[model samples]
Target: MGVDQNSIWNLHNKLPSFPTLNKNEQTEVLIVGGGITGLLTAYELINIGLKVMVIDASTLCSGTTGRTTAKISAQHGILYDSIIQSSGVEQARQYYTAAMDGKDRILNILEELKMDIDIEQKDSVIYTEYDENIQAIEDEFRAYDTLNIPGKYTETTELPVETKAAVTMFHQAQFDPLLYIKQIIDVSIKQGLEVYEHTQAIDIEHGNEIKVTTDKGHEIHCTYVVQATHFPFFDPLGMFTTRLIPERSFIYAGKNENPHLKGMHLSNDTPARSIRTAKINNEHAILIGGEGYVVGKNKSSADPYKQLKQTAYTLFPDHTFISQWSAQDYNTMDSIPYIGRLKNKYENIFVATGFKKWGMTTSATAAVLIKDLIQKRQNPNENLFSPSRFELTSSVPTFVKQNSHVATQLIKGKVSDEGKSIDELKANDATTLFKKGKKLGVYKDEQEVVHVVDTTCTHLGCEVEWNTYDLTWDCPCHGSRYTYTGKVIEGPAKKHLKKEEL
Candidate 1:
């Protein structure tokens, strides 16, 4: 029963917490999240003598940063071909350069600080098993050639699975993400980076100055703000929630003294699997990940860990399962991330999100681009990642299709009333019940105590379904999630669910 809680990074790194926001604060720049993007942005700003403040609803490095597979590579799983087809060859080159720059920046910082953070360079590969995906792999190789990227296609790989073809990008890397982030945080603190943890940013009021209101009734006034909370908590631009598609992917680790490969590898076929190496308990281990589906797509609320267990065992039968975890990410209509001004009119407000699952390098790319924009420097890559750069023919149809799917989910949520009664549920079980014209999500603990909460999502009023594996209420519409006891765990939901006595 390994689950999302058992990430290998969490076992090795623990971040110290900061006091919650207690009083009104003012700063030149405010970063509303303390994940990798926010921290890196703070690091960059503080070094340039700008007064920067970073606040996290939880502790630093406690969000998606702690949950990633930690692959630091420019090779984002057969992406160049699609980018070239969608944007152009020049834009594809820029995207490739941006990814490499992100990797190089991290390497340079690590070398300058001389942090022993278990960093190692290796080739990244996107391989395939099915014959149908071979042309896609070949097309990716052709795109690499057009972009002058240092990569090659091969028929064989070091993986235990029989990959028919693969494309490899050299000089890529993997590292302990928390360890790398911790060094920047330490340096940022010394450089006067004000970091507050356990402080939830509820909403932002726009006037002459942006007022970021916290759940504790304190407001942070800042000339500039970056919403780097995976999903934008406050979307005045109204573009994020509509364009971003929330997805959840699973990761599992196991003990293996001798594992398959020295590099990061991803399968291009269906039920895609990614493999990389990690150090666990002074022994070698292999991390197998990737079984991504949009949040709330599963009707059974099926645990991804079951399929992951089968994948791990089938690939590395000698290894013993150690941990399992899941991470959430947002995908844009296009594959590129939105990393600059939230709107064309608002120069002071910025946001960085829609990283898809390739966040290790994209996060750094975002930090650098956002920093350039705040300093009023012209970033060449801005147009490539612009939030407003919508392709009428390409993106409009996708936008409409995504919203149509959402409407379908909303309609389904309104009509469906199909859960066992709360009295019939057993301990350690959850069920959604329609009682007296009210939809209630009830979960009974091992101690036979029942916890009940209103099942409507606070973000868009979508009816929330019980996730049995993770013990949370998940939204089918926009992927907002909540704890069984009605606490908000993820967004675009900013408010906790209504509580009810059981």
Candidate 2:
């Protein structure tokens, strides 16, 4: 399984199964995911003596949180300047302050709970080797100055790679997120915060008390429900799918012979690259991530993993990568995350999504804002990140363009045909093939077992494509994913694909 189990965080933090929702339950709040956001939300709510139940389709931290680079920082890649230009200076400052507050919240929790994890404080650097991008870097520095953010504009970095310009944000941090979260799980359980695995929240019936129905046919009636799943699967608002687009990126980890870098580095370039170091098996290994593209729109004829592997080789010569994995993220139309009440009419329902790739800080911030909303308190960042706050001028064109692209992909998927006959397919490979004039997703295991399912996505009609690296059927439309055997893994799609006989 070459780069299949790519994230080192997942390798170290395998969790045991918790109970599933077999009967109806009631709570003050029902959190619909067990990743960092859900767990953190539950922890916060439970601290205030509210009865909270957190459920996941899988185990805790098994989603995108387990697959993250684990960089906790305010330097979200030339973001402040863009926010200032679009939303304004006060909003940008609030964004910066919220990010720092997020980092501090994590530390405060760890200290209060006495949780031991491999967390380190380091600077975060946003750099670019391209000369053309220097003005953007300068503009970001100016934004930093206006916001009074603790950062310095630098000419060089501790990165082994050469650079044209860099912005260093001071005292940022990195850690093994799962390990820390595991401790949170233990404390949360002890504090009467209920957790259920293998329990997928299928749909929510909004009322005075929201009723969340799970895949297992159990109901969780709660005063409030938080959609912490990476993509807001049950978008009662009918606007989340349109407001955000899913992005996929790759990460390669290997031992480096050079001196370990002191800072987390991200490139401000077209095809972005991020560098950070981690301790693996008692030795330091470098993690190089970033080759982002719209999900299912990987137009490059070359495999993305191969390209990232080559990048790792160039950056760390003679270093053999132990693991490589890919993760998916969603970017909002206006760039800022939506992290509050789902809609005005439905006050009991809330959502936290569109964190771009900066989930560590954003998710933490979201937890506080969500808690405040439920507790009936004022949060300074509420207006900036309100789920209903739509920026018509900037976001409308982007919303139309993204949806148009989705429409184009939907048509392209239906019309395009590039598949092999069952007899021609090699072992341990997956492809979209026509079987008896029907488009089907085909996967052949190493033991020569064949699995076939309808290539059409269950969420929307956009045809699903075979992801060779992760061995799943991915949708270009809304980022829903399915296993080769037609089981729904991620959603936006509540139902599994229709299975087909080979």
Candidate 3:
């Protein structure tokens, strides 16, 4: 079943909003998003005595950062093995080191500020669901050894389900992402960083001085512009449409026997599950996450909540279900993020994106990398994630598949026939209806109230599928999900679908 407003993260709190840009503005540096990436960049720039301005399409931290699982770790599940094989031993080692260093930097900041945000040092484990991948897990262990990172290979895991093998990393961590972001924003503001929420950058005029034009007709003139808006809004460098594919991941929070796992954990196999624990006030909660796929690629099932519930029950039947939410992330083709300059063509314009599913650490790393680039300092990981590094042959298949799906949706026939009445919907079920040639998706909650919204997704105008597990309308093409009331629950859709009058 879909979660109501009782989410622990959403408890007793309203997000901070900043006024939209209304006129031409000037700053030394202009950042285009207010999430972790943008906020951190702004904060770092301000601390370095550079004037920085951050603009967001909505309230700060309301985007992907707010919905994140909030795990702060260098152990991006089963990635070290793949990185070592795909890139090289040195590149993999550097990546892991950079991530760990970033995690330490965040912890240092939290300690400096004396903020208590449920920060805990936990071990991170990567396990395989089936025995067929035992050798692969072993290979990953060997790769970790090459990096001198201590990881133990074991058959016993913390999950209630059985696993063949697992590799565990010690001293990893997780925290409440929203609290961390809010603290940073407050500090940045004190340091004279200008922030404008609900301000959307519509176009950019790149030259000696980059001019950012917002949807409200306001222009920001800056010597440097950072495209930290999850996906860069401009394609002058042709990055907005390529190099990365957006994907969706779901997470649910419930009370369980604490699993007492030493650290956060994830599974390497399909239907991946990420496990962690959090505290709401004084009570502990378990967060189980998995069931992710490339957007629009799968619609075989209307809901996966039952599967999550079953997993929780099987793992720790003694716990209770509390809060649940899902998040969407962008994945790059080569399994690495694209940071540094926008491209060779645009020297002053910078971009930070394509963190795959490890944004919490990668985004911080991006801030460090971009800050170094802006200050003309040497950063070790710059070439590793440079935007110009093109391995086209490896990415072409995914690019073709994703764009082909988008093209098909653009020209596909619309459902012009009227569909079922609102009264026909049952609690916790949703149906797509066409009324007078306008397509609508209606969902009835546990309270038997119907919330209607346009079935069309704001991103690329694709038809959205009903996600019963989260009780939201999901777009298959770009992984955009929205609440039944038409509020965008996830992105790369910044705008909400138009709500239908009930």
Which residue ranges in model 2 land beyond 4 Å of their true spot? 1-6, 256-258, 434-437
Best lDDT among the predictions, by candidate number? 2
Q: How far is candidate 3 from the true structure (C-alpha RMSD, Å)?
A: 3.3
Name the 10 consecutive residues with the lowest summed lDDT in model 1: 1-10
lDDT of 3: 0.78
lDDT of 3 by residue, 1-502 (tens): 4634334565524566688788899999999988889988887788899999999887787667777787888887777877777777998899998898788878877877777676888888989879888888898899889898977889978777788999988788888777677788788888898989878887888777888898788789999999898877766756656566777777777865445667788888878888788865667787787888787666557355566667777776788878666667888777788898976657788888887788888888899899999999999989988887875645667678777877775555254323556767778878877776778888887788878888888876888877666677877666767878888765566678998854
Worst 10 residues of 2 by lDDT: 1-10
Report the candidate with higher lDDT, 1 versus 2: 2
On residues 1-502, what C-alpha lDDT tens digit does candidate 2 reach at each position? 4224748887766665699889999998999998889989999999999999999998888788988898999898898998888878988888898999999999999899987666789999999999999999999999999998888998788766778999988999998888888888889899998889999998888776788999988899888889999888777658787778989888888876654678899999978898888875467777889888889778766677787788788777878777888888899998889999876668778889999899999888999999999989999989989888878866888899899989998889887766577788898787776767778888898899998899889887899988877788889889988878888877588899999987
Per-residue CA lDDT of model 1 for 23-141, tens digit only, reads 99999999999999999889888878899999999788777889999899999878898888877898889999999998998888898778876777899999999999999999999
Ranking by TM-score: 1, 2, 3
Cα lDDT for residue 263, model 3?
A: 73
Which candidate model has the greater TM-score, 1 or 3? 1
Candidate 3 deviant stretches above 4 angstroms: 1-7, 12-15, 116-118, 256-259, 408-461, 469-473, 481-502
Residue 109 in model 2: shift from native, Å? Answer: 1.0
